[model samples]
Target chain A: MLKFDEQKVKENMEGALKLRPQINEVVDQIHERGFSNICWLGIGGTYASAMQAVVHMKEKTALETFYENAAVFLTTGNKRVTKDTLVVISSVTGSTEEVVDAVKKCNEIGATVFGFIDKAEAELATLVDHLISYPLNEQLKFFMVADRFMYLAGEFDEYDEFYNEMDQHFAQGIVEVEKAADKFGQEFALKHHQDEIHYFVGAGNQWGATYSYAMCYWEEQHWIKTKSIESHEFFHGMFEIVERDTPVTIYVTEDSQRALSERVVNFIPQICGNYTVIDAKDYDMPGISTKFRGALSPFIIHAVNNRIDVHIEKINCHPMEIRRYYRQLDY
Target chain B: MLKFDEQKVKENMEGALKLRPQINEVVDQIHERGFSNICWLGIGGTYASAMQAVVHMKEKTALETFYENAAVFLTTGNKRVTKDTLVVISSVTGSTEEVVDAVKKCNEIGATVFGFIDKAEAELATLVDHLISYPLNEQLKFFMVADRFMYLAGEFDEYDEFYNEMDQHFAQGIVEVEKAADKFGQEFALKHHQDEIHYFVGAGNQWGATYSYAMCYWEEQHWIKTKSIESHEFFHGMFEIVERDTPVTIYVTEDSQRALSERVVNFIPQICGNYTVIDAKDYDMPGISTKFRGALSPFIIHAVNNRIDVHIEKINCHPMEIRRYYRQLDY
Candidate 1:
């Protein structure tokens, strides 16, 4: 594997798994305290992750959950948000200005805020009422919280079974997915590294991943121009731009919305000669149940797509951390 | 004024305004019937338009409102939707496959549906419980329904006055906006017609206009590659790709979230010399009150941007109505 560190990957996954106990404890406390609804507030990548969680919540649980962009939420506050709202936020640096300001506003509104931050000393960690500092797999952490909340609410019956399965094989399963995906990722990176622009499409729970990877990784990290649309929306406005030689990538999920992406897959080949389909069902997850696959597909898809990011970074000779305007010079 | 028909636009705007009496009648009937919440379901351009309405509703009303992509809503139904839910939908042709299917599902759920369709004989017009068959200026129609609902609920006290003022100035105001914007639009089109791609940024009420114009107009209608990002999210990932020569257009709104776009305005000129700012505050609305500008900015901005579309259509020698794959091909 090119630039792959197997040990570090496993260690990071295991480390994220270790936070399950803390996550459970926090969720239990929040559940005991009672909340009118759940609000996930974030910006950019974090915002996209929160959107995936909210989509999952809509599918499995009847819990009132809202996903909001931190900055937009700050400007146009939701009437549903109140003292009884349980606000969940995440930040890798724990210092995204918008998320920090939003957390402050949530605090002023007397809402209980639980944040997933990478550093305990970060500003967001200090502001949040409850903070989880181990942030390796944010999607998994959010699922754990949502699953626990559902368990307490008598909505998710497979909570213990799900976590128990994850304990046994989650880390290794992700590694397997990455390994399976690396070959295709390298090939894709080699082929499309110099392409002017790419169109990415996904539906269901994978929409957030598709959106974030296209903008945050491909555009931000590699400076590649890209357009991402929901699979259902691909036929709307985006389809007109697809020519025979246009490069298109479709992330097909294993959820109920698989049909939506299948529609795209069936349609894209008819118009686009250069196209790729990354299907979640193509990968094998030995321990995770099919019933929970839809809920966990975002994480699976993320792990699988990480290979592409690494390969693209290597192919383009662009360090994933390089930025020209973001935090490099003051705006 | 190339390809511009001032008389046609005025007539269309006035024709749309004429539907207000029928719109008010339908909303009044729905008010009497009562609804638990309002749900706007649409796809692509209509979805973006509904999004703007939801954004406005958030700032002005305490009503429980939802904006959802029709296809996604069909796959993963929201728990908030119920028999008492008011589902608002709009379709120009009124036979969009996913929208038609979603309307059927909404009907199965027994939710009261109000639809805006251009043709009385359209499939959707026949399906919806209450249908308004005049579809010019959809944003205005959506706003009118929203305003009426809020008025009946005691959330909008100036609804009558607002409509009265719009009736007096809205049509001519839009014409004035188009006239004011033509020169700039022609200049912009002539300058950027040959550019490889464009990056559009907008915030608050103008985000939908920005998104729809970039995708539905630029990409779908004109086959031009473009990327649109919300102003707040631009700083997240899109900002990294922007250079001194990058062609960026920022839509600045007059809403509460104006600060979000202002932040981008304050930063873009320093980095990108080719950036253009389309501020909603620059246009004057003589008879309309400043209090309603935030709610009306989407319509105002849409009218202003029409000039750009008209000019670009003429410059590129590509008819906006021509599509290689939309309805011409069966996917």
Candidate 2:
């Protein structure tokens, strides 16, 4: 039985909101550090958030900041700290081997390490020079607060009131997430009535949303035929595979990809050749809480991903089970 | 209506082979230009090859290089040219807008421009201070020649009889491609069984191979449900959606990702619910044209993709004519 405390989701969302300014303060320090490249390292859900953050950094600075293992600290270790490379490591447990390995690797080689974790005094914290902890909730999967906060630290400038604003957003966000679950939950459970396949797509900041969809579809429900690509690249080649009457969902965003969001919705029938779009933009998300910008949109979108897992699992007529385990990259 | 010159593939292949060393010899020369950052500008296939090249350069020297486009050049045109940043611009149709735009961007910024083209007196030639041209048979798409030379560039050390060896590679490569077309062409054409969706995945060097497969699944066969993702990221949350029997083709390498490759081939069956693999290690793709390292592995695999496309279209019976007159990005 999964124990998802509604209060916990509310609290974490609020925490992400409450801690937004603290994250910004950290970002101020990083910008001052003047590193040319920033690599965010993490595992599992945290790893996913790290990847999304790395992409956000690359787009903002045109610098080659990517997700890597802490082990890279051992190899590409910088002899002297310059404004060239900075590494941000995150781990929910803070004890995942790769994360631990990366932490030690950062230690062996004199590379700068900034960490995010729920457990401030965790083993990883002991290894890193600077560490920050996210507001922890009872639910194990509540690090979205920390992720959004850390990402804000690396990006925006006027987050003076971000913490207060984010808390408000998360309090309201829980209601929106429940509404999404209540609205789509049953329809998602009707696999027997529908065709034999399913697809989920997230556009722009909604990549995090689609990621949650995959978690639901493949992890809890055990559906294997789902995928999400950055919406801009979709038109280049993947459009031909959409079939007549196939179930497809697209996440909307107010980011640079808003136009792409609109395009997919309009062109679905024309381009997919036959599939229909199940819209989700009407489901309001808690974007304001973390002072989450429209551009960094995927963060707030992650909440609904949990319900989607149930939707897929209940429909599959199978026990809630993880049919496939994925490769978690390590340092 | 399509004019594919038969020999153009061969000529370009040889020309690509010739251009490799020139690119290698001059890469060091441009590195001496005193720029701290490197930016490569290219379009279409040239851009695709550049993606592969930059990864190789980064792996080999640990130097930081960037990829820029003309449209966003002014915004991303920030790297200092003081021996730390290097600019490499490439195009098959040397007149492509992006290439010309990059030339202007590089020149205005006082960055050294290294231009590679097929035509000697091409428009790109006029824009660049340092230009290199290979007499590739322009009658073909940059597909064949780009594959040939890019592969060679990744493989051989210039001083090691690279050209003669690759000359033989092209000859053997042609045979390998034709043979693949023969085996998979019929299966590619078997589109009547439309119950399944296809997801193509490639990692590291073979990343570009799936691009060719995209054309095969979408353009050639008109299968609109096909999608491609890099194999490394394929594991994480993405692996969860491997439907009860979704078709997944893994493109992997023997050297770098050997461990991951073996693990995925084993993992897919359980998680994907249904699966298949085209293993690079088990499959023989001509002789190891020592000069055609990992990136160009796509060219040989493309023969398989090309065969699939031509074969799928052979089923001319389905009259939906799924091809839309105009392509749009999203729904």
Candidate 3:
């Protein structure tokens, strides 16, 4: 619990929940205007976030959704992004060069682009057709958008019930998740913070969280070397590198592909002495239904990972915000 | 080329070329039967190969193509795949558990499944609707399928010309590529064979090759720890972790996203003194058009990388085919 801000975490979750009405209003406008397909565009962490939503849509809905890396999209435009495409994008800084350029390209293509920006005065806020300034809970905002679209499309019958449950329990449930994870996260950091390299494995929608946490948090924030591989992919080639003492972390979700990670969990411990399993099922979500757990696994895993990051920063005596090259020197 | 057999490589390349007529015949039947969409399924290296083809299809053709990891496809079925879906798969052993299972699942869904197997008696060959017994050049076969489909759909007008040029030049062109790359590859392996972790960066179509080489060749074959990142993604988070002497290799391709990798190539030298650029443009493909270079960059890069693998295997004194777990242990 070192350096953990309980009050701030609560406020951020509640604040994001409060954006439901605005999110619904924006989604309503999108529904009214109509779109042929949905395109989620982002870069790095945001790209990983969008990928989680796209994976969910692919599983439960018939909606045509495309997840693209903002930089790649900016450079080599997707043929699917026609005037009728609905482009959904997000940027924490609202000034990520690639995302901003991609948003402009989307507009030039006559696509209806809506974006979530952290600052109303940011360049991207001004560029997008519909801009929602929400500073926290990016994954939550993305789910709201995806769920609302599915609801309107008659693909999600539990839409109202799910959100109602979320309204009543999500903030408290997530706080409990963080509290539950704090001790383990601290212990994990204490044990493996100095490891030369870490291998992260996860499956289903949680794959995005696995990927982002390794790149955005471990490597970027802590300046650690890491490799993030999907659970199934881990067996393909990466498994050969695992020794008895190699440090590995596998995330187990309640999603349909849970068995994939379970396979890794089952296989790794037999070969690797240093391995950790961060299972979403271990954290209680209070009143949330089991049916929705898979859909919400990314949020749960990310909240748990945030605790790990905090402890890693504290343990390593390295401020999470410190960067040597990013925005520091000309590339 | 410490362990490379130039004559063997020539035979393999020419053998793959000779299969072009059979590849076209299979593709013709697929065209005649007609499919609403294309699904390329594989695991590990094959999955990476399929991704390169999908990226190409996305750029040039209006075809609805889905690239999926075989395990994930088996566990969580994609809604886009149906009876009219054309499932293209590959397996070297023809007994990859997840791939065999995925092909069965595809069959159950009544989809038309065709596969490339190294042996005619392989399990996957028996299961698929159309079986192609090809022992080498998996990427070339994939390209043939993609290009032929595009040609039939009228999206690629120069397909015949491209293949004609390839028929005339591909085998010799690739041999020359390997010869050109031998010294550099050997030097790279000798210089960095002891490095704890190597970072690989590539963009566009070459991204798949980058990912596969790091996992399949470095990790699986040599038991080396490495991280493979896309060129654009490197700037986002991974760049922050790069030190002055980090061993970073950037694969610069002739594709549209070449600038993305070029940016990495240009920036890395400024920060990191130990860096390598394996640019596809540097390799010559006799009689092949400039327009075809981008599409064929993966092949050129792979041929270049094969030399690197040979030298790594030689310097490390670890046979590339040796594995502690893969098919050797009950994991």
Go through the candidates in order and give the C-alpha RMSD of each one to the true structure.
1.6, 6.6, 1.5
* Proportion of the native interface contacts kept in model 2: 0.24
Clashing residue pairs found in predicted model 3: none
| DockQ in order | 0.75, 0.25, 0.76
Give the distance in Å from residue B222's predicted Cα in candidate 2 to where it truly belongs: 4.0
Name the candidate, 1 or 2, with the larger DockQ value.
1
lDDT by residue (A1-331, candidate 2, tens digit) is 2335777667666665455456556655666665555666654455556655643443344345555533322333332223355667766567766578766765655566777677877777788766677854312222332343344455335434554454556466655666556545555555422444455665544554465455434542465555554454445345455555656666766554566556667777654544434344445655453234553345434445555455655665555554434333221
Error of 1 at B160 (Å): 2.5
What RMSD does model 2 have?
6.6
Q: After superposition, how far is residue B271 of candidate 2 from its true place, in Å?
A: 7.0
lDDT for B112 (candidate 1) = 90
Better of 1 and 3 by DockQ: 3
Give the range of the ten consecutive residues with the poorest summed lDDT in model 1 chain B. B295-304
Mark the 10 consecutive residues where model 3 chain B has the least summed lDDT: B57-66
Query: B1-331, model 2: which lDDT tens digit per residue?
Result: 0123446656666665555555655664554433465665654344445555544443334445544434334332333333345566666567665468767767776677767666767777887766777654221223222333333445324524544555566545654565645565565446323534576776554554465355434533465566566564555455665666666777666434434445567667665654556555444545554334443455555555555554555555533345543232323
Model 3 segments beyond 4 Å from truth?
none
* Residue-level lDDT tens digits of model 1 in B75-184: 88887788999999998888899899999999999999999988889877888999887756788899888888888889888888988898899889988988888898
Candidate 3's residue-wise lDDT over B47-135, tens digit each? 99888888878667767786988888877778788899999987888889999999999989899998889988976788999888868
